[model samples]
Each structure stands twice: as C-alpha cells, then as structure tokens.
Target chain A: MRKIKQWTAMGLATVMAMSLSACGSGKTAETTTAAPAETTKAAAAETTTAGATTSTEPVELKFSWWGGDTRHAATEEAIKAFQAKYPNITVTPEYGAWTGWEEKQSLNILGGNAADVMQINWNWIESYSQGGKSFANLEDYSDVLDLKQFTPESLDLCKVDNKLMAVPISLTGRLFYWNKTAFDEVGVALPTDLDSLYKAGEAFKAKDPDMYPLALGEYDRMILMVYYLESKYGKNWVEDGAVSYTEEEVKDGMDFITGLEEKHVIPTLATISGDMADSLDKNAKWIDGKYAGIFEWDSSASKFKKALEGSVNKPGQEFVVGEFVKMGDNNGGFTKISMAYAVAGNSKHPKEAAMLINFLLNDEEGVKIGSTERGIPCSAAGLKILQDNKLGDPLTIEANTKVMNYSKFTLDSKFEHNDLKANPDGVYYKVFGKLSSKELDSAAAAKELIKGVTDTLEN
Target chain B: MKSKGMRKFLAENAGFFFVLPWLIGFILFKVYPFASSLYYSFTNYDLFNGVTKTGMMNYNKIFTDSDITRAFMVTFKYAIFDVPLKLTFALFIAYILNFKLKGVNFFRTAYYIPSILGGSIAIAILWRAVFNTDGLINAVVTAFGGEKINWMASANGALFVIIMLRVWQFGSAMVIFLAALKGVSEDLYEAASIDGAGKWTQFFKITVPLITPVIFYNLITQLCQAFQEFNGPFLVTKGGPNGATTLISILIYNNAFLRHKMGMASAQAWILFLIVMTFTAVAFVSQKKWVYYSDEDGR
Candidate 1:
C-alpha cells in the first residue's frame, strides 16, 4: 500500500510536467495561429484597393523572409522607408535563418497564420496553392505589383493554375568552387574535369590523409547525379512530376557516387554530418580547408568565399572559382527562380502587402535599400537600378554567368521534395547510407532508390 | 424537496468549479487531439489539401511498408539493450552512493547533470562531436598510438553511440533508486544482521525486497522511454549510416512532417501507443511475481 502511494505520487508528477510543457507550446501556437486569419474573399480588387481607401487606417502587416544579416538589414531598412511613406501602415519584419524555415512556414500556412507578405521558395506555390486560393492573386493587386516590370517568363514561373501566386526574386543554380590554398599546399593541381577530379582524391589524401577533394551532402550528391545523368543520357532526373531514371541508370549513378567514395573524391556523408553545421558555409572542416571544394549555389557562393577569407585562424586561404566538373558530354547545369515573395490569401490587406512587395522589388527608394540583398533581383527595374549603381556582388555575377552559359537542363521543383533529404525514412538518405555503409551494394541500393522515388511520386 | 437536495449537493460539490480551468484545458488540449488523431488515422490527411476519408488504407499499408518494419525492429533492439543496462547501472550507482562517503553530494550532482542536458539538441550535437571521425574520441585514441575509428560512420558504431547517450542519462532512475534505498527501514536490515546474516545476505534479504517496487517502477518507465527515444538518433546519427538507429518515433515524425503523410503517421502513432501500452501492462501484471510491497498483508 505504501509502495502504491509513492508510485501514484511520482506518476502524477510526471504527468503534470508533461502536460505543462505541452500546454506551454500549445498556448504559443494558439496565439500565433489566431493572429493571421481575419480576411475574407476580396474577389474584385479594383483601382480603389491600391490607391484610395484605408490610407489613414492603422494597419499592422507582418512581412517575413529567411536570409543572412545583409538581406535582413536591407529588408528592415526597406520596411522603414515604406513606413515613412505610409505613416499609418506599420510593417513588422520577421526574418530568420534558412534551416527548418520552410517546414515552419508550411505549418504556419496550414494554420492560416502566415505573414501578410512572405518570402517563399519556388516549389511552395505548387504545394500550397493546389486546392484553393492559398495565396492572394497578385493579378488582383497588379495596380501595385507591376507585372509589366517583370518578364512574362519570370512571372509565369510563379503562377499556379493561372493565379499570380508569387514573384521571382532571382535565378540560382549550383557551380563548383575550389579552395586554392588547400590545393596549393597539397601540391596537387585542382581537378578541372571529372576524371581528374576522381584521381585528385588519391593525390590529396596521399599528401594529407585529412584532406578530401570535395565535401558534398546527400542532396548535393543527388544534384551532381542529376547533372551527370543529363550529361550522359541527355535526360533530366525528373520529368512530369516523376523520377525519369531507369533502374540501370539509377544504378549507374549510385555506382558513380560509391565510386567517388571509393576513390576518395568526396568525404562520406557521415564525415560531413559530424560538423553539425546547417550548411558548408559554417562547417569547420570546410572553413579550416580540410575539405577543398564544394558544388553549391552561386548566390550562396559568397558565404563560402567569406568563410574562406585569409584571416587570423586560417590565414592565406585563397578562394577560387572552378569550372563545373565535366561529368559527361552535356555537363548539365541550370538555374531557377531561387526564391519569391508571395502574399497570403488570409492577409487582411492584400493590396497593401502587394505594395510592400512592389516597393522592395521595384520602387527606386526600396531598390536603394534592398539592392542586391536578394541576389541580383530578377525584376527588370530592380536589376537596372543595381547595375546603374554597380552594386552586384562580383562572385555572384561571375558564377551565374558561367553556370547559365554551360548548364543545359532546366530545373524541376519536385526534385527538392522533403522525402529526398538526408533525414530518417528519407529515400535518398536511406539508400545512400546503405551504399556507403556497405550494407547494400550499389545495385541493391539503386533498386531501393527507384522504389523510394516511385513511392514518393505515387503519394 | 428535490430542488433543496440539488442545491445542497451543489454546495457540497462546489470545489469542482475551482478545478474547472484545468479540466477544460485537459479536455481541449489533451483529449481532443488524442481523439482527433484516432479519427485522422482513418482518413487521408495532408497539411495543405485537408482530410479525405480513406477507410483502412493507411492501416493496410503499414504492414507492407518495409521502412515501418525496419523502424520497429531498430526501436525494439534499442529498447532491449538500453533498459536493463540503464537500470542495473542506476541501481548500482544508487547502492554505492547510499554508503556514507565524503563529497558524495557533489558526485550526485555531477552524475545528474548529464541527465538534465542529455535529451536536448545541443547534447545530441555534442554526442556527434564526440563520435565523429576526427572527434575527441579519435583524437584521444590516436594520441595513445591507436588507429582512428569511424565512430559515427559505421552502422554498429552509430547505434552504439546513440545507445551510450541513452545509457549515460541514468541519473533519473538512479535518483529514484536512491530515494527508495533511503526509505528502507534500518531495523529490517539490523534484524537480518543480528540473525547471522552477512552484508550481502542482509542486503538481498532486507534491502532488495523492500526496494522491489521502486525497481518495477523504474523498469516500466525506462523501458517505455527507451522505446520512444528520438533526439539522440534524430540529431546525432539521423537514424543512419543505413537506418540502424531509426527509432519508431523518428519514423512516425518523419512520415508526418517530411513526407506529408499525416494519416499514415497517425496510424503509426496508434500502433506505437498500443505497443508501449502492452509493454507497460505486461510489466504491471508480472510485478506480482517478484515485486514485494512493504505494506501488503500486514508486513
């Protein structure tokens, strides 16, 4: 009986603690979820919506984006300038790093609690705008959004089911970068072609066993495989919302990856994962030059270069742009609208939100503040302003030019589906992990990969 | 007369009004979600497209799914190894610390600190750092003229690292055992010693029997916790080097959030709930065989 009493007390305490934590998180979600859902169908957004009514009304618009310090600062400044013009409209800036931001935003959208004007990835348009008007039609607010300033192709990329869902920010694609200092120290020339790249792995390792020719994650390797397939087979990885690779083709790609591992061309995923950094930019191995190269986004190339600055810790670190590794005859490389600004369907002030997006992407004052913060802005007026001011980052410009000239295949959004990531139960992660761990050979892992991708497509 | 009785009853039962806030929260926050998940398990629920009635599709698919089966096997393997070892270590530490020793309080706090920090993402990162290829473990090993080992890269090594993280957090179970040891009556042990019992004999006859209930409690709770373990695998190994550490909870979460298969995820959760409940129920039923109750039968 005494034992039963103590058990009861302890169990009750545990339950209370569990309930308390749940309650705390639930209360926070509730407050946040309720704040963004007060608008109704504004079917006819006329001239009066943009220029006339509610100018004097007190409006609090939440605008959110994910970026580094420069982008955040520039966006904050643009909001202040917008606030100066429209005194009654208070635009609150919500920004964060990119890690897990997409998932958080998806949850926010599900709860009808997304910001009024938010920065969204290109693929989110397909995911969220499928069933209903999940995003405000920018066409309705074209009086402010200025569709004429953007090219039809740029505008078309953001449209879903003929609704102007989002606006293209800039074009982005992967390109190669080499750590010149590391290569020089190892006394091995940087690998310019695929065959040479594979051979460089052994050369670098012989000089310093800690050094790897490249460090790419599962997703990075996947992208490389796509590039390889397009180069060799003249086919994109995905076509018509499905993986277009044959079992043999996928096996070839898998073998190629495992070969790279066998040849020590790239560090294994397990080794790179040890850093626990969100991206290669912050990875200590990459920073310290133990890892010598990356196949990464041109827009994000600045951060990698910045991380490689010849400074106090790793002085005399020289960064150099490398040509894309010639995997096949085609050497596939492509760019897409990296990110876009979209207005929430639940937003109370759709026209005003459009105004804010327009200001940031078009207006001279907005351009001055947010210039080149979001890569080279895809908007014609925005680009002209940045070019006139000579404000584009040189590395970004050079890298984009190189990739666009060489890259042949176009991008497909379905490639970046969450299932393809290196997470638990993720198809690519599981199959690749198996291949690397030698639990399954490349052919078996390839069969698993095909099945996984097929399942993802079917679902 | 009935109205008078009702008013009298109301006055007597008025304390329920005071508890109304908690009761309301429990029903809304806890009970509602719990029931809704049951309903969701039968439907096709996607975050953007909303729910569609899908009958037993999700439940049927669960059996055929290879990942689900693998996850279940991995989780069982983890629980089977973790619980008994953790319990033994906790009880042993409790026994040692039960002795009168100098600076024992400091030792207790230091041992308990890892338990406090062990469940978080930061701790998971630290675990990864400790086990990574060029991590502190390899550094130490190499310093001693040993070859470096791939601690987080190999399937077995990753699983072992995650399990060690779980085992290292034995302080909670240890503290409970310590409390139970303290509660055992001094006279019971004294009587055993006076009756020509040796130290080991006295401990087995008096101490172990009295603390059997505490052991049962720790066993049940730790077993459930081990089965549902997530953070260590999710953050450290990410259930990898080939899904060797993919716990069922990680599978369930990834299925829902990453794959956007809410209905299937709900089905998986219900399956997990039933399994954990069955384990706990078995433990409770078996307790009568070995667990000794101090106040039972006029003892």
Candidate 2:
C-alpha cells in the first residue's frame, strides 16, 4: 500500500512537471510576441505625421537575420544605436544560428509574419522573387537611397532585372588559409599556383604520414577551387549560354580531386565528414602542427586566427593567408554579395521601413554600428566608415582590395534562374566527391549528376 | 427519468469536456495538418506560392528518385538491425534488475539517464566525439596497436554507429518489462521450482509466456520509434559521407523546407506513415499466436 501511494505521488509529480513545461513554452512564445509589439508600436508612432509639419511618429520594425553570437551582439548594439538616434523609431531584432535560418524564414514568409526587413542570401533571391509579389522594389525609393555610394560590383548583386531589390552588406571571396607555425616547422614555403599547392601538400604528407595536408571539408569548396582553376585555364564550365556540363569537363574535374584522394594527401572521406571538428581542436592537427592549410572564406580567417591564439595546448602558434590565387595579376577571383537586407512587401509602413534601412546602411552613425557585423558594409559611405574605424581584419581588407582591383562589375550570375531548382554547388560537390573518393567511379558519377540535374530541370 | 437520461448523456460525453484542450489541439495541430498534408501530397505546393494541383507527379518522381530509394533502404536497414537488438538488450537488463540486488535503483537510474537525453543535441555531439576517426574509440584502438579506423566516413561504419546509438537508449522498454515482471505472482516461480524446472526452464516456460503481451507491446512501440528516427542521423552524421545515412525523415525535411518542395515532402511523409502502419499491422497479426493474457479464460 505504501509503495502504491509512493508510485501515485511520483506519477502526479510527473504530470505536474509536464504541465509546467507546457506553460513555460507558452510564456516564452508570449514574451516573444510582446517584445515585437513594443517595437512595432514605437515604429508606428515615429511614422505618424501631424498637420502642416512632418512630425516624426514613433515607428517600430522587426528585422531578422542568422549569424553567430558575435554577429548577434553586434547587430543588437547597432539596432539600439539606430533607435537612439531616431528617438521615435524602435527596431526589434530576431536572429538564430545558420543551420535552421532558411527553413524558419521561409515559414515566417508563408505565414505572413516575417519581419518588415530581413537579411537574405543571394541563392534565395531567385526563389523568393519567383514566389511572386513578396518583396517591395527598392527602386521606388531611389531618392532616399544613395546607390552611387556603393561599388558598382556590390550594387549589381542587389539589382534584379536592372532594378535594385535589396541592399548588399558585404563583398566576400574565398581564399586559402594555413597554420604559419605548422608550415615553418615543416620547412615548406607556401604554394602560389595549383601545381605548387599540390607539391606543398605532398611535402607536408612526406613530413608526417599520419596528418592530412589539406583540411578539405565539403565538396563544394573543392568544386569551387576546381572551377577557379578551370576559369584560370580559360574554361567556363557553367557558361552563361548552357545549363548542362559537357562530359569531358565533368571528367576533368572529377579526376583532379580523385587523383588527390588516390595519393592520400586529402583526409579519408570519413575523417572529412565525421571528425572535422576534432581534427581542428588545438590538441589535434592545428595544435600539434600536423595539417598545413584550409580553403575558407575571408570571414573565417578571423576564426582560424582566434583558434590558434586561444589554444592552451599549442604554445607560441601563429597562422596567416599565403598569396591567394587571382584570375591573373590583372584579373580578380570571384566576388559576390554575401548577404542583403530587404523590406517585406506586406509591411504596414514600407516607406518608414525603407528609411530605417537607409539609416542602417548610409548614415555615418549607422555605418559605424554596422561595420564588421554586416561584413564590410556594401555602401561606399559604409566602407569609408569602416576604413576610418579600421574595423575589419587586415586579411579581409586585403582580400576586398584585391577583389576591387581586378574583378569586373558582376551581378550574382550563379545560374540564379535555372529551372533546375538545384543548387549546382551541392550537386557538383556530392557527385564529384563521390567520384573522387572512388566511392563512385567517373562513369557512375557522371550518370548520377546528369540524372539529378535533368530531373531538377524537368521538375 | 428524463433527468436521469440527460445525466447519462452528460456522463457519456464527459470525457470530451475533460480532454477538451487535448481534443482542440489534436484537431488544430494534428488533424488539420494531416488533412492538409494529404491534399498537398498531390499538388505542386511551394509554401510561398501556395498549393496548385499537379496530379501525381511528386509521388511518381519518388518512384524514380535515387535519393529516395537510398533513404528508404537506409531506414529499413536501421529498423531491421536496431529493433531486435534493442529488444533483446532491454529484456536482458530488465531480467537482471528483477533480482533483489544492492544498488539496483542506482543502476536503473544510470541506464535511464541516457534515454532521457537520447534525443538531445548534446548526446548527438557526444556520439560524434566517440565515433569520429581520431575520436576516443579510435585512440583506444590505436593504443592497442590497431590501425585507426574512420568510423563516420564510410557508409557501413556510419550506419553501425547510428544503430548502436539507438540500441543504447533501451531504458524505456526495459522499465516497462521490469514493471511487468514485478506484477507476475511469486507463487508461480515457486510452483515451477517444485515441478523440478531449472532457472532457464522456469524463465522460458513461466516468465516468458506470462510476459509475452508486454514483449508484443514493446516490439510495436520500438519499431515505430525506429522508423521515425531522425535526430540521431541528422545531427550525428548529417546524412553524409555520400548520403549514406539519409533517412526518410531527413529526406522529407529537405524536400519540404530546404528545397521548398512541400508537396513532395508531404507525399514522402505519407509514404512513411503507410510503411509504419503496414509493419505495425503485421506485428499485431503475429501477436495472436504467441501473446498470453491473464484474462483469456474470461474472454
């Protein structure tokens, strides 16, 4: 009887705990709604005008983006500063990690509860634009926007059909980053061209058979590197005129990566997919001075630098970017808009929202707030602010400068309108990686890629 | 008499009121979504553009899509390997706990803790840590003078790791079995012993037969859970190493949200539902031959 009573009490406690959890989730949702309401109310007041004179009514606008904690903190600080300057406007911020951002944002758009302004990626532009009548054309407010303040190349990324659709936040390019201490200890000079890169990889392997020389992660990065080489060799696999790859070009790209795998200079397919983080941890390759280099975006240079500096296990460690591959001494590597901000078409106060966007991108105070948070701001005015503040890493600055010097003004060409609704990058990486690792041979890989691309196009 | 009739009416429907919140939630969250998804399974419904009927194209595509085939195979492989192993482990652990041993509660708690955190991200990260190429397992193997194996990079290796993770969280089933064991009368074991039955003989002839119903219940529940397993593969392996670990759930997620092919995703989900139902029905049909119930004589 005592045991029975005890069991009943335990069951009751479990029930109570479940109820409390439900209530807690409800409270959290409510708080989320309430926080946005405060901002919206303030925004409405800032936009409201009195008779004869334009009275700045309090306005509140919700904006959402995805980034790490550092990015989040910087953005929130920027929003607070923007709000203080406006006095009558309130800006609410919503952000999450990158993994689920796309899905969450798409659902919010579908549900018609998406923020007034949102930070969007280039790949999403075509999809969202095709979804019909969802975004306000920034061209309508051309007077408010200083388009000339941004580089033509950066501005081109914002334009869809020759009309500015969104404001670019950053100019990004991919480059090779290596552990300086590791390379020095191994007594190997940094590689300049594709041949030298391969040679350096071989040397690193000869020095330490247990370590992987090239810390390749995803397939797309490899594909991008191959494309970069192909482009330098004067072959555009994804020519503007054609949607499909010729069999020979496909074979060439496949064989290149596969040959590397055959030599075992690259990590095993499992190590790349499974133990990537462990491989990077200080006590692992990066600290032990085993791995030599990594192919990463300009933003990641800071992270790689920080990791080496913060490692407790690795004493007196340093890392830096070697000479990056440009199109030539005269031509630049690929540069595109990394992210953009757009006003939702269904916003209650589109003009007011546009003003807020203008303030965020153009105003000196706004530019200062944005700085590194928005990834080397796209506007010329914003760039000036960053240059004055000396905000970004020197490597990033160098990368941006190189991009500016050699790259032609180009929009986000990236097969944006391909009915193949497939991210060519994803398809290329998966197919090529599979082929190169000998998991699937050249012929089988070709068949799979063709099938995937064709199916996506037909659909 | 009329008042009594009215009282009967209220009594019969009282449960509706008692569970009103759940009923409302079931209709709004579950029933409504299920119906809409059923409709969507036949349409070209991108979430943003809304729904447009496209006949059976999405379903037709599923038949030919290599990725879908791979996902189905992976899910089935997981179910076949994971379910029986988990059930056997659960039964063994529960049988051990049935004994009146010191620190049994502590052991039970320790076993249950993994199940509590089984679906969490932290556990998934831990799973990766233990199974990665240069991870603890590989390090230990290397220390023993064995060649370092990359467990997560190869197709078979990654699947084995995932199967082990599912099997490790068998505590819920074990607890149920433990409860069922406690309910079996002590007199039965004594009776079996008097009949000259050995311990194994007694377990097979008495305990096994008596608990066959609980075993059936567990089998059905675990099979469903295994079929719906997503978090483990999605987080631990990310359906990678050349899409070796892509399950139906992840496929559905990618189609609906990632690719914005909501229609195709919905169809995939319904297909999964059908697969679960068919397996469950088969289990129920087989149960009649073996499951033993105490109330059988009365029935």
Best by lDDT: 1
Clashing residue pairs in candidate 1 (N, C-alpha, C atoms within 3 angstroms): A333-A407
lDDT of 2 by residue, A1-459 (tens): 644444454455556556745764521121122222222223323221211111366566888888877777777777776566556556677788876788788777666777888888876666675533566787676555555666675666666667666778777666667777777776777766666667666777787776655666544344443445455454443444333456655555556566565665466555566663522433256555566676655654566666677767676777777666443333324556778888887887666667667767776666666667656667777777778877766767775665555444233244332232222124654675566457787667756666655545444
Give TM-scores for every candidate, taking all chains together and pairing residue i with residue i: 0.89, 0.87
In DockQ, how does model 2 score against the reference complex?
0.31
Q: How far off is residue B264 in model 1, in Å?
A: 0.9
Candidate 2 local lDDT, residue B168: 94
What digit string (tens of lDDT, one per residue) describes model 1 on residues A1-459?
644444454456557656766765732111111222323232224222244334455677889899999888778778877766665677877779986687788888877889999999888887777543888989888877777778898788788878899988887889889998888888888787877897789888898777898988777777887787887888877788777888899889888998888898887777765554546776778888988999998878888888888345687788878987887777686678888999999999987899888788877778878866677778888888777887777778788778867886877766666776637566777777777767788789878887777776776
* Candidate 2 segments exceeding 4 Å error: A1-55, A130-132, A151-153, A161-163, A232-237, A276-289, A325-333, A404-426, A450-459, B1-24
lDDT of each: 0.79, 0.69
Report candidate 2's fraction of native contacts: 0.39
DockQ-based CAPRI category assigned to the predicted complex of candidate 2: acceptable
